[model samples]
Target: MVVRDAKPDEQTVTSLAAAAGTAPSMFNAQPWRFRYLRDAATFQLRAALDRTLPHTDPHGRALHLGCGAALFNLRVAAAHAGWEPVVTLLPDPYDPRLLATVRLAPADAPDQELARLHPTLTRRHSSRVPFRDELVPEPVRARLRAAAEREGGQLHFPSIWHVRAILELVRDAEGRDRATPARAEERERWTRTPEEARTATDGVVEQVLGPYGGYHSIPVRDLAGRHSAFEQGDPTPFEEEPQLALLGTAEDRPADWLRAGQAMERVLLLCTEYGLSTGLTTQVLEWSELRWPVRDPESGMGQVQMVIRLGYGPPVPGSPRRPVGQILEID
Candidate 1:
């Protein structure tokens, strides 16, 4: 119920789109596009189907999650820029690719909560390295859970047995990928070569791949697989009881995935603010057979969206992002 003024300037649109593009994606595919409707003062979010992983994400659920994360970043950027974002998810059913339309309206009072997170936006990066054994404190865990709840999602800390089971499933997934090389096509496509890693605008690179978990069994996804010649430096054992959390929604629909993505980013930002390093493991969740068992049997919250690992660890370099001009279109 908010009215828009004249079209937003090109600079403002570009800045917002650029900030939105910083959100993380599976394998750094960044499969999302933005279009600024000058006349309507709205920014449209659409899935970049060409950048999607057909083998791993056939139904485009992961793609939607990535786009939703970008949408959240857009909202935060708009608030930081002193504008209120009025969002409409799946705005047009006839156009399924159109994920959202955000109208930038003048705000009587800007959202301070969202604006405060701007500083942490660029600081948050996925750490593939080993995390210390130290546990995340109760107070910080409470805050993370609250952050997820605010975004219409639930974050659950799995039991020891559940963690072991999840790790086993992840190992199974890795073994399957090794055996079925065809399934790795999408992964290989998104992982850059050494030379390309240095200059490429998108995709995960060798430097961020971290040391291989030779003896230790941390649930970190091995982006390097068997192709990279990069040596594993200072192989140290990861934490024995690594802290893990499960992000889930009440429902398993596209809209719910969007909410889960927003929640995931919120929790991640909060964790970053608390000096916690984070990593994600979605290999088990990628397959339906292994995904069901990931949920906490007691909680009855079965729709798992992401598995988060958090601890104190070394800083990870931020991945490159596509230029704002490449992602944003003005109409």
Candidate 2:
């Protein structure tokens, strides 16, 4: 496919790809690859088939979601660099791994809206630590909801009852994961031991996983694997009243997952910009039986893409990312 777009410099291309690589993914799986067409000036985003979390993310939905977040970052970075990025998703049915393509053209003017988010791309980290028990103001909540809508998604702050139900679902899934043979295999596959984390560039490293027990029915995924929900360290008290937001799309499909991923990162970056700490609660969302119940029955929202925890807290280290040379290629 050809478009009236200009090719970016090699240095600029790498910088943009670096920003894209920072987008959050399931388990920090970072299941995305990039190919820059030197002659055509187009970039292709692909799903690294090997990085799939088979047990937790069957059907490659999480792969698409993670790649979608990376696509969003690529756009933001391109915009910041005074180039307009043209994107095409799933361009070839025959090439299922090809998630998207980005072509950059010099912009007549800067996209300030997207450009403003550039600083936040690297600033956002998935904080697994305990957040202070404080309520997010209504104005801030409204801004987050709007951010989701801008990218074809909805963000709903659940009622107290709904929050309780979702938490229960997460606990149920974690219990099953502990007992299921395949789940154990998958968990062990991504979890790096404390000693192993120093060198490993991906997966849930021991450094980022905070602790074992927590209070208030918090739905944080127990990545502290020692054969249980949480078996690593002392109990860490989360917020007494945890604030939860569900990001959803109107439909459930590969394309919808991509949009939702973009929306999820947009929300996360905004949260970072607003000086708020956040963590993802996908334990319930990962399981099909539990994911649907996460939606508030009263709400008209569609498929729940992600569940986000928002509040004030210490910004803990996030999972490591693969090297750019490993994930991106220039042709």
Candidate 3:
């Protein structure tokens, strides 16, 4: 059997890291790190304990999900680079921080489908602005479900009363956060001011924060609400009718969260490929009470991991990523 070289060159490593680094995280915390073993052509994904948002992601499930998204991007990057990526999740039983490992082997026939998604990596960003209230077609939704299912997760589109329940739960979560000073502090910690955003490497900045409601009741998380201490955005009208999808997995475990994260990213990327804008909110899911009811009583979707908004909308700037040098170690 032919084998790949023991070590990939600097350019290849940087390119792959750049793609993987584009994955979305809770509040853009980017709670993940990477280590490439040059001698073995393996990339190890580890949790960035320093970057964890403890209050919102108390159990590190969101962190694992973000890391899984990064892992998915890494796989796509590898396939585009003519390498076969063999991945193992939770390879180490004792080391909880070590999330996954990917071994890259040279591929004579690379994954064409994954390679097609290479361009979408840069194009896929969370659209925080208002999307047209038009419903996504059933066929398009089916394709999105296929994307999620391929990654060991499920996606369901909920309209009518289901949408009302979700929106109310999000408002409830918002009210709960407002009542508690500590919960409000979570948004403050990850939100960036206009000045900070100009040079900041991470966090939800002013431009993408969208704005507070004026005439609409969308469920977009307002990260910059506490302007007395941080920058706050002006009020803007959002779509009255938002198309929503619930992405979930069969089980609720670290591994399941990771799978949901991958499925989430895959669905978003596929959405981008179809020229659709997407945004995601986990606000209700952070609170257990609101989280349980997020499931559709009409259908069995396991544990609802993420609430995703999809539609046609104007593009927003992608959040900045930490320099590859900061998150990647080659040795």
Give the runs in model 3 whose Cα sits over 4 Å from its true position. 1-7, 214-216, 226-234
Task: For each candidate in turn, give its C-alpha RMSD to the true structure in angstroms.
Answer: 2.4, 2.6, 2.4
lDDT of 2 by residue, 65-148 (tens): 889899999999999998888888889999888888888876787678888999998889888777887889999999999999
The residue-level lDDT of candidate 2 at 117 comes to 95
Note the Cα lDDT for every prediction shown. Answer: 0.86, 0.84, 0.87
Pairs in steric clash, model 2: none
For model 3, how does the per-residue alpha-carbon lDDT over 141-236 read when each residue is reduced to its tens digit?
999999999999999998678898899888888777777777678878888888888998889887877756632346787676642322434556
Q: Give one digit per residue, the lDDT tens place, for model 1 in 70-101.
A: 99899899999889899989988899899999
TM-scores for every predicted model: 0.95, 0.95, 0.95
* Model 2: lDDT of residue 92: 96
Candidate 3 TM-score to native: 0.95
Clashes of 2: 0
Error of 2 at 223 (Å): 0.9
- Of candidate 2, the 10-residue stretch with the lowest lDDT total is 225-234
